[model samples]
Target: MTEFLGSVWWMIVSLGLLVTIHEFGHYWVARRCGIKVLRFSVGFGKPLWSRRDRHGTEFAIAAIPLGGYVKMLDEREVEVHPHERGQAFNHKTVWQRIAVVAAGPLANLLLCMLLLWAMFVIGKQDYSATVGRATGMAQAAGLQGGERIVSVDGRSVATVGEASMALTAAAMDRHDVTLQVVDAQERQHQRVLPLSQLPAGFDERRVAPLAGINWQFWLQPALVDRLVDDSAVRGVLQPGDLIVAVDGERIDAADQVYPAVQALGKRGGPGMIDLLRGGERLALEVTPRQGLDGNRQPVWQLGIGFSESHAPAYDTVLKYGAFAAVPVAIGETGRMAADSLGMMRRIVTGSASLQNVSGPVTIARVANVSAQRGLDWFLQFLALLSLSLCIINLLPIPVLDGGHLLYYLIELVKGSPLSERAMAAGQFVGLALLAGLMGLAFYNDILGLVTR
Candidate 1:
């Protein structure tokens, strides 16, 4: 419950920051264009607090934090005073109106770039892909125990984390991925393995499962950063114990250990016993507990904590002054933007499933997890979210920036404004599309929760 509450709080904060920035873009530009802004709100629904500035623009924080809007004086409304005609939004030229409409998305993009630059300037820790140790039958796959992986699929990998990400991407498509590995003898070898052929029982927790690759990338153990009193792992597991195995299954990595434990309880076991306490190998048993009220569904619980150790160490770290960060920020932001556009195109072309569509619940979960990981992870997550916001808002749909742009273009070509009734119809269509998409996203979230 505490974790959930924390996630909700973070979600609110993130949304508030992004929405304020986005709306402020429009508000500032509209004001500069000589439009009379009636309200500049940080959220939707009823105002929680409001104050009017000297320019008569009402600045407000609204009840709902999910979104925000700006209301400008418009001559199209019957309530517009004759004297206010010059300040009306509808009285603005097409170019001016387009500028106001485009500013919000543009602001989101700018914020994303700035955040990326900040991350680059701060310098993030990097991990190498060398295996410090390897064990079990899987260890005998022509891989020297101390081999270091330098690249995958022709992409340069500076860290173990990068290698893992690249391998996972390759595995999803069952593609044959090439790896450049150097052994303890310093002998370099290039191997091509079909990622889809990776072993099924390979631990996904320690390293991402290669579709066909048997070699496991190592990760540091999970350390107990915090523990819930009601958590099953709390009493049974200690903070310093390095998880070795669950129910006799050799735990090769941190990711492998917890899921294997959870799977044991999920399969209707009372709980699996495990060894920990480092070299001492103390044995402990855990039990499953029902989540959320007496729902009677059992999940693995062991009241203990684990922290990661043996993370890859970087030899060189890059940091930048504010002035030097701009170019780096621009490059990173462009990469992220391009990636998002590609993914959207794939999904639209039927290469991706609708199930990939995530709503607020998934986003909140991601935000929580990213926050737990570290500040760098959180910043990366926010960058991706910002890109999504920019792209989605610019989609040529009604009730969005793109929809307004469409109207402007039509007016420009037709030499007259669209009929009020026609505009209303377009709005209706846009609203319907928006609502339907929201419903689908909500449904997907529910499905995920239930399945979990």
Candidate 2:
């Protein structure tokens, strides 16, 4: 119950701020365009807090906090005095009207830049591209421990997070992807992973596993964080022991340690384990025990968990001076927007899964997760989400800013506004299309939960 309520609260906060910023854009632009705004509302339904501005705009926070609006004086909606007619939104020139309509999404995009700049200044510590071990795909691709993965699908990635993002994108679009890697001897080569071999209806967690990649930056001396009671080897190994090697192979990263153990375990039972405790090197004879995965496949397993703890020598926090953060933020935002748009285009063209469409449930979960991570992470999440929202709003669909701009465009070409009946018909169609989109997103969310 607490978890559910936390998600709801996070959703409300996230949506409320974004909606206010979006609506304020319209309100600000409308006023500047000489349009009289009847109301500048931060939410819908009954007014929770209301005030009238000196300029006669009613400002309010309404009961529902999911969305908001800038209610402008339109001749079609209200009778205007002859002298006041000039201040009506309908009296604005076509270009002026288009600008007013476009401002909402534009504001979101701008907000993303600012948020990212703040986040960059605050900084974050992420893992680099060194692996401790390899299994499944990594092993099959002959990726030994300690190899540095340079790129995914030809796109350079400096961090493990970047590689994961690139690989995730590739996984959704095709049956295979190429990873450019540098081995221990500093030799460069490409490894091709066939994600297509996975079962149909592939979900989020399955992608990397099926593609044979589990990455870890920290080397083999991983201190045990926890051992699940259900794990067969839980009591065989105690926490805080530094695992330096598995069997005869020297293990630096956890990635290198895994394949060596799993393969040996398949031969029957545990293998020789070499570990360091209290600065003393020791050897313990052990074997990998037979275990079942989620699919009930019998596999050799080690019941060990690793938590985020820097090995002083391996990782560093990245902080940017305020002066340096702005350009970095702009560059990152631009790249993110471009990548997102490209992915959307692929989805539209049926090259990607429609299951990617997520509803409020997924967003709420993401919001909760990000908020839990840290302020910098939450801010970055907000920036990415706001940018995506900006693009989504700019899509040319009725009842949206993009739809209004489309009408303004037609007005420019025709020398008059669209006929009322035609505008009404467009709005009707737009609402239907929006309903369908919502339905699809909700269905996808529910389907994901059920499958899990």
- Give the whole-model CA lDDT for all candidates, comma-separated: 0.74, 0.80
lDDT of each residue in 1-452, candidate 1, tens digit only = 97888788778877888889889999999999999999998888999999999999999999999889999998676478888888999998999999999999999999998777777778755556776554332243444446777888787776666676666545444466777889878899876655566555343323333232233334565544556787876677766666677776766566676577677766765655555565686666666664543476554555454554555445434467888989978977775676567556745775445666889998888888888867776787787788788899999898999899999999999988899999999999999999989998999899989988
Q: Show where candidate 1 strays beyond 4 Å.
A: 126-190, 193-208, 212-318
Candidate 2 regions off by >4 Å? 135-142, 175-206, 217-239, 243-271, 286-318
The lowest-lDDT stretch of 10 consecutive residues in candidate 2 is: 309-318
Give the best candidate by lDDT: 2
| Per-residue C-alpha lDDT of model 2 across residues 250-361, encoded as one tens digit per residue | 7665555668878788676557788887788988877666778789988777777766665444353456899998898898898799878978986899766888899998
User: Which one wins on TM-score?
Assistant: 2
lDDT of 2 at 444: 88
